[model samples]
Target: MKHLKEVDAVTTELREALAGAGVVLPSLRPDPVSIAHRYNPPLVELGRCSMEVARRLTAALTPTRQSRGERP
Candidate 1:
């Protein structure tokens, strides 16, 4: 729980910095298979990074949701 809170704090700070830079972060939603199929190197790199973060967040949150009897 402490680690989660620390990670959240770091994420918040990073987001604020990005916002101050006028950089709009893209959605981290998993790309549809059709869309992912069209990516070249740069897009692929971005997609991979987003996917990794999304996966880690999902994994961390899932158990907490289950503990609360929530259907995610």
Candidate 2:
């Protein structure tokens, strides 16, 4: 709960930016591994953020032509 607000804010911003750029990312859901057992909420959130961060970083590092809706 401590970082809920921060995480939600970040996720929302990421979603909006991606949407604006015509990029659609899959929603983050409880992992199947977590369903089979118990998992911490903070860690789950961290995982989602990790995924989003990696996605954004990858996109940012990609060539400008590819990122700008141009043929590579």
Candidate 3:
């Protein structure tokens, strides 16, 4: 739990980012095992979402005219 706060902060930030893109990760959390060890940095587990969520996420991540402040 060394980086507990840091992990939570990052997880929350990601949630907000996803929210801005109309995405929701129902089971977002910090991986306990990852933080427990000292070998690697803590990991934020996005957990699971539906196909629609996947598609939306992909769309948000992908470049589009709207994202670039362009008009159709």
Candidate 4:
């Protein structure tokens, strides 16, 4: 719980820092597998959320934006 909050806080900060650069990262949401227990996600579920965010971030980077059909 504490760890997740920490991650969320840092993520929000990063999101703000990059927003001006046109790199809008997705906000982290509760993992679908653990939505019913939003406050207590298991380690594996947290990992899944992290991976999803990573995938989104990677796709948002300049090199991949053009491939995704957006002007880079």
Model 4 worst lDDT run, 10 consecutive residues: 40-49
Q: Give one digit per residue, the lDDT tens place, for model 2 in 14-63.
A: 66776676555565433444334434433222233456666775775577
Best by TM-score: 3
Candidate 4 lDDT, 1-72, residue by residue in tens: 665665556656665665655454454433445434656642222223366556655655647656668985
Separate clash counts for every candidate: 0, 0, 0, 0
Q: Tell me the alpha-carbon RMSD of every candidate.
A: 15.0, 8.3, 2.1, 9.1
Clashes of 4: 0
Alpha carbon lDDT of each predicted model: 0.45, 0.54, 0.91, 0.52
For 1-72, candidate 3 gives per-residue lDDT tens digits of 558889999999999999999999899999888988787889999898999999999998999998789998
Candidate 2, residue 38: the lDDT equals 37
Model 2: residues with Cα > 4 Å off, grouped in runs: 29-61, 65-72
- Which candidate has the top score in lDDT? 3
Off by more than 4 A, model 4: 27-72
* Whole-structure CA lDDT of model 2: 0.54
In Å, residue 25's CA in model 3 sits off its true spot by 0.6
Error of 3 at 38 (Å): 3.1
Error of 4 at 53 (Å): 14
